[model samples]
Target chain A: MAITVIPRGDVPLGQEHEFFKFVCPPTFGGGPVDAQPATIKFARKLDVMADLPLPAGVKTYNGGNSLRLWLIADPNDSSSNGATFPAKTIRTKKGDVVWVDTGFSFNTHTIHWHGIEPTPMNDGVGHTSFEVSGNFTYQFATNTAGTYIYHCHKNTVLHFIMGLYGLFVVDPPQGPKFAAANAPGAFGFDPVNFSVPIDVEAAWVPGEFDSIWNDLGHNAFMQKCDQNDPAGAGTFTQNGFLNRFRPDIVHITGVVSVPGNPITDPRVSVAAKTNQNILVRLVHAGYTVQEYTLGLDATVIGEDGHPLGVPPFDKYSFPFVIPANTPFRLTSARRYDLLLNSPNAGVFPFQVKFMDWINGTVYQTAQTTVTVV
Target chain B: MKRRDFVKVGLAGMSAVVVGSMEIPPLFRCVARAANLAFDMSFTEALVEMIDKTQVYHWLFSADAGFATTGPSLPGPTIIATYGDKITINFTNNLPQPHGFRIVGTSIGTGVIPNVNKAPANKFTLTFTAPPPGTYLYIDPFYEPVNRILGLHGAFISLPKGGNTPYGGKTTPNVQQLFNDLGSTPQFPGDPWLPPPANRSLIWLFHQVDPWFNARAQAGIFINPDTLKAKFLPRYFLISGKTGAFASDVPNISIVGNIGEPHLIRILNAGLANHSPHLHANHFYVLSKNLVVQNNVLNIDTFTVGPLDTVDWLVPMIRPPDIPGLKSTPLRQLIPHELTTVLYTLQSPLMYPMHCHMEMSQTAAGGNYPQGLITHMIFTGDVDKVPFPV
Candidate 1:
């Protein structure tokens, strides 16, 4: 079993610690390396300083959205190769041991692996399990082959929006069974053998941030909990804790060129030869509902880490064809792995659409594209 | 994808095509086949004070939905019907503000309206096809965030057509099961693949209210939606409108049930926050969620019920009498692991404290902890004093 130890932190990690203390100032139960960091971030910082330079093609919203994430450092790699936000794409074979060290410099955070059935102790929910303050090692064996989500469990309403998340993909071991199932020779079935496919692959982690929630330290908004209408709008008391969750910017793969700037939003790229299959893993870490439409015909091979139509789970899982125009809806923290077969060389965009939860209305679309030549 | 486009694409067609691949058992399986039944109901506005004396200006359903009398109750009573029954509720809104109702589950009817006040003081005759027996929710869809919190929701249950037994198949006909009979063993002795049968079924419609909103609305003050969003902290957590908001009243807390009979605890979280309900002595088996039976019922000491989620568990009082159908020896002898029996069968009836694991929910409005959302499962000295109302 391969043991992969991944450390979670942010780029210019040192600056994030400074910023966290500055906004949450020690007075309001926030400071450098405070014990109860998750619940004690700055109350309200309408304007925050961007101590770190913006990544190429990335912009900020609301005095700059401050939460920059990175999953860096492979303990196995002695070299200086380390963590970066939209943390390095985690790829592993089934049965490999993944030892995730959640060493957050500021605030408390727990890593909840969406759709992965880890023990309750390993299930990183703040209230359910102990939240990691400084550093804690979470060890688990990847048993299922599918695209899964990983995000901070502390103060889910806020922490998830603050951009502490990534995707975890476990690949099934290749074998005779896998080869037969994904045989390209099967007529009209250029199946991208997900079990050990000889094809290109890309992982799309679709998420958004509420500019306001990310700008202020968690403590600032939490400070307003159960208080009178500070906003003075007066409809009723504000539930700062209730997750009003109005995000201004949406991006893919943790590369937000600018908050509220979806125009230059990034899309994952993959190349495959004509008639070759490309595997696309669509995963969600954001809090709202997302619907995705594949530009080309694709077969859904797995969902939530289970092989479609496999025994026992066949009662639930089944391989369904996504007709060219049909869309697959994903609630918060859902994953779908699809194999896209390209008959012609061109760009195939997966239109990831967002909706307003209060009213079932499609509001926006974020695109992730794959090009085959 | 646009909403209209999504609807056009095949919301209804998708389910039909998917079900063709597999055979899902009929929702509720009962032995006693019954004919379709219908009922009429209405909503009336009332200023009722909760257990903590916090007055809420809310809409309540009158006990008799029989077309004439209107007396609103806290958690409008449960609407019980048999599978394949047709429930037609004539919900007349008598409040100053607009109100409407919708029954969720099954495709019997389209009972949703975007706005209840589109027609001033309207009366909506909603229809529902009740099949696939399970617990369902009927809430005020309009301003649900506001109206539901103001106490405008109720429970709806559809029993299998003719069977007193839930999920009837393997066991004897006298045994009434809640869902399908997966069949049971001496170890389970109740529902197959589930816990022992409960003699009494209790519904705990969990809800919470922000006292500040209740006070503001009661004073006839206008509340701004944005401001309301800013101060939305729910302090008063309740189970069926009990659990006083003060620690001193803990002794007189509402009773969950008495010992000797396994209690089917139906827990529904209508509030915004997730509730981790922790039972004291006896761990329960989560039999079903919403109304869908699980492949294998899970045994848990504390489980979370998220907002708008429903969970049903059998809080077994003891090792039930091993019956003929369980296919195993009667569990007359206690094993070392059977601690649930030792604690419950103590010489004197005991009160086991059960509360929310979130900790904050058990507090008073002013941040006093251990005041709200806490109760006890009472074990009576004599089995005759079974606490629940049949």
Candidate 2:
């Protein structure tokens, strides 16, 4: 079957205008190394394109700093810029063919659907035979029911940093039945057509940025520079751009400016009925390592793009519940979908800490507020 | 209206003005475009003058027909090319010793046959197709240590083909911007993110000179190559053949371009040691690494370049109208910004420093720093006049 495709655009967000102001405090963890309140910094900010409205009957989300989880414009729209960072999210049911129009005019790239085992021809990679150019479409089928990731495989080092990836979730066939069977404890009555027994769902993607690296990588001057030339290599040797790994900021959902300050409100909150089970999908879309700890008990129901079940695929996959206060680790491009068992009548925050994989220094911290009322 | 207010309103109003059949203003129409389509270099031995008012013997290359090596622009010539174009160079070696030329991107085999007893062949020739545009280097590989130190190195660049031509062997439309990943529209010529194209580019050829080596070579002393490497101590640092605290201070070394234009900067490290070229007040996009055009590059200020490394970059000659802290000083606040659109325009020309981040190379013979391998990029606006258009 021909897969349905949609188009979206990703516009850069920077300090291009004078109206916007940067409100983050400058420091490693938004705190001073010497322990003093850093003076608030300000600059005219760049315009961040608004996310697309949710499609009819589809879930809506902002992955990073107003980045939409779906197509921003119609595919037939001729006036669009034709470039989208974190290409439009793909939401479908298991056993369905999904075609994504991943073509971009800005650069050469391939979309590697992280978890799907598509045929070599359908898998998007530059070295492989599946690379697409101009306005070609990427077609594949969802054989597994789970949450997965898709990112550019071309120039993996630089293209991925430019935000060329998105989340792809394939729901089970009996989603409503599963939700109805596992009704919220707060509501004594079983609900009809409930989706996976969840009262609320949220997505958290951890990301980092080094403006200098991003800017330099996107520069046109070096586009043609001879990389093999011994005397022409451009290397950064400063604390800010050190060894090409000094990240300016560790951000959540893309709300923070790089090489600047951290914000006071770096949290996302989701409201839940008292005793409701909340499903939180965590995806690590950056190069750094992340550790997410929960203050309330939550069970790991799925990993990568497959739900834990059955003999071949279900071994040690499901029913693995982590007690509150324990941390789970996630490497780059990894995903974990957790079903949280909300505690008593109070707000429980899910704490996440990001750190460098090489060293053990905390780069950033974020909390997702789970308000159980 | 205040002076600043009038200036802003006047410029904004001029955008809408149509002189009968004219769409753009006369001032903008006068803007010039620069392109370096060809190059000619000759390798010869001559007495080299230092920036610190000193003189030494040196073997160098220059575009000058006389093969003049003792001047402000001493390090040979930069070959600026665009994508899809074929470039040919006829090199005449005036030095007593035999030398050959090898460029990175071009398919020139190493021909390091040294001239023994003044051979009949005193010239070399090279022609090649340039593409996958990027910064490259031309060097004398035969006598790597001796000849290179004597300043026989320069930069080569393959610019993006102009007027709608695809680059890097891709079927996509011609790159409107410098890099394929930058944006849809071309950034330099005319764009909201930058001012009008001033039509200029820049190249910084970095090198180091050991006064002792030059003095010995000048006096016809047969210096051992191994000994030279073991006792290597550089005194004078150079950028584009001139040693100065700032690029503007050195004649023919200062890089000047029109404000608001995206200028291409090719920085080549021709020394034995590594040096980090840092741009103050602005950051540039590194367009390539080695000789390959990168799909996605980085924007950096200080880039550590080792010996023989070439870094190609695109620097937009624009800055914030007024820095948040420097608004009080009239000298610092010159650019104009629209209150409603929040867009910035390069109103008055400005000068920014480009120097080595190594800190020590900025000095002459280990004296005060900021004298060697340092220069300035002049963004010519109404406030400053440009001596060299490109």
Number of the top-ranking candidate, with lDDT as the measure: 1
Put down candidate 2 lDDT per residue, A192-308, tens digits, no spaces: 432355567666776665444444432212112122321111221112222233354455554342223222333345677766767777777665556877777776666555454
Cα error, candidate 2, residue A228 (Å): 48
- After superposing all C-alphas onto the true structure, candidate 2 shows an RMSD in angstroms of 22.7
DockQ of each: 0.02, 0.02
lDDT of all predictions, in order shown? 0.48, 0.47
Per-residue error (Å), model 1, residue A243: 2.2
lDDT of 1 by residue, B86-117 (tens): 66666556555656676655444324433345
lDDT tens per residue, model 2, B21-50 = 222211111111134233455676656556
Candidate number with greatest DockQ: 1
Give the range of the ten consecutive residues with the poorest summed lDDT in model 2 chain A: A18-27
Which residues of candidate 1, in runs, are more than 4 Å off?
A1-81, A175-198, A218-242, A257-267, A360-363, B1-56, B62-75, B84-136, B139-151, B162-390
